[model samples]
Target: MESLKYHRLQQRLGYTFVDQKNLQLALTHRSHGATNNERLEFLGDSILNFVIGEALFKKFPEAKEGQLSRLRSQMVKGETLAHLAREFAFGECLVLGEGEMKSGGHRRDSILADTVEAIIGAIYLEAGLDSCRDRLHSWYAERLAALSLETTVKDAKTRLQEHLQSLQKPLPEYNIVDVNGEAHAQLFTVECKIATLSQSATAQASSRREAEKQAAAAVLARLGL
Candidate 1:
């Protein structure tokens, strides 16, 4: 039953492991035991960066180094990886400990993202770099196809920074004004201040990073950019 459950994930990944233990280990969370997927996640992160970097380099000969770096970052970031994990129904196959499982750790973005990377590492170890590359390419086909120098999907912070840089204006400043709630789930209130603008934008989210992003987006909307 356990093996059959993972077989479904393998089909989605488009690669089956020779030694199924690799896949099992890759899905194991640190909370599950000492022998977990952390090492595999690290290896997979490096491989993912290299593979995505090489792909971007070939796909866009005219792109600058910064552009390629941004593109690769966008592709390999936790949010993107978590989205891929959702696509593969990874939450159902994650091997979390009793506490983590009870607390809905399987649905966590970080855990899902880490598991995806671990799986990548497992594939690399099982076969080779070519297999890993092929799987990544297959998985990221739509996202890769959508990439373009002009339409690069950038975060609000990056876009705001670039906008300020182009206009020779002072960069925006972010300050955390307030934090509410407990340790596990806190609401952060961040204010984005622009030197030229008379008014600042404030936003709140579950994390400081997200709050800052929302504030930046609000500032951008004010600027009419």
Candidate 2:
């Protein structure tokens, strides 16, 4: 029944599934399958990276390799995938076991993103690269446009530094004023001072970089940077 629903999803794409199991596998969460979409997600992740990378490479022919990679990364990020899932309403058909269903597994970033990758993987396997490229771009066209507007996905700190540098202002500084939370999920409170306006944010992550990103996003919001 779940497989049929996923096939219906493919039909909605106006693309029939070459391998029904692949699409089914894509839809299966770890909580549901003895083995799950993680492996498929891994393959799909690479496929998407390559596909999105190539797309950007051609679209922005003058962009350097690093810039292209950053743009692709931004596009393939979990948040982007989750957004795609929402756009396709894939969550509505996600077949979660009882536990995951109760825990909001269908809407979770990890689940939704992985499912997206798996679906892409299934698409690639079924319809080949041309079809994959076509379908993927239909989703990514807007994202590509938005990315073209942004200078880079270089994060708020970079943007802030660049902004100050362009204006000949001193570099912004991030001071870890406080740290909170248990060992597993620590939150770092960072204060970013840019000229006379001081802004701060707390980022919670499993690692420092993650925390910094969270903090930077906050600082950007606070400073309107």
**Top candidate, metric lDDT:** 1
Task: Give the Å error, residue 47, model 2.
Answer: 0.9
TM-score of each: 0.83, 0.73
TM-score of 1: 0.83
lDDT of 2 at 219: 62
Best by TM-score: 1
Q: What is the per-residue lDDT of model 2 for residues 16-75, given as tens digits with 9 covering 90 to 100?
A: 776677777778887775867777778789889988988898889888887887787789
* lDDT by candidate, in order shown: 0.91, 0.74
Which runs of model 1 end up more than 4 angstroms from their true locations? Answer: 165-169, 176-190, 196-211
Deviation in Å, model 1, residue 187 alpha carbon: 7.4
Backbone clashes in model 1, listed as residue pairs: none
What would you estimate as the lDDT of candidate 2?
0.74
* Candidate 1 lDDT (Cα, 0 to 1): 0.91
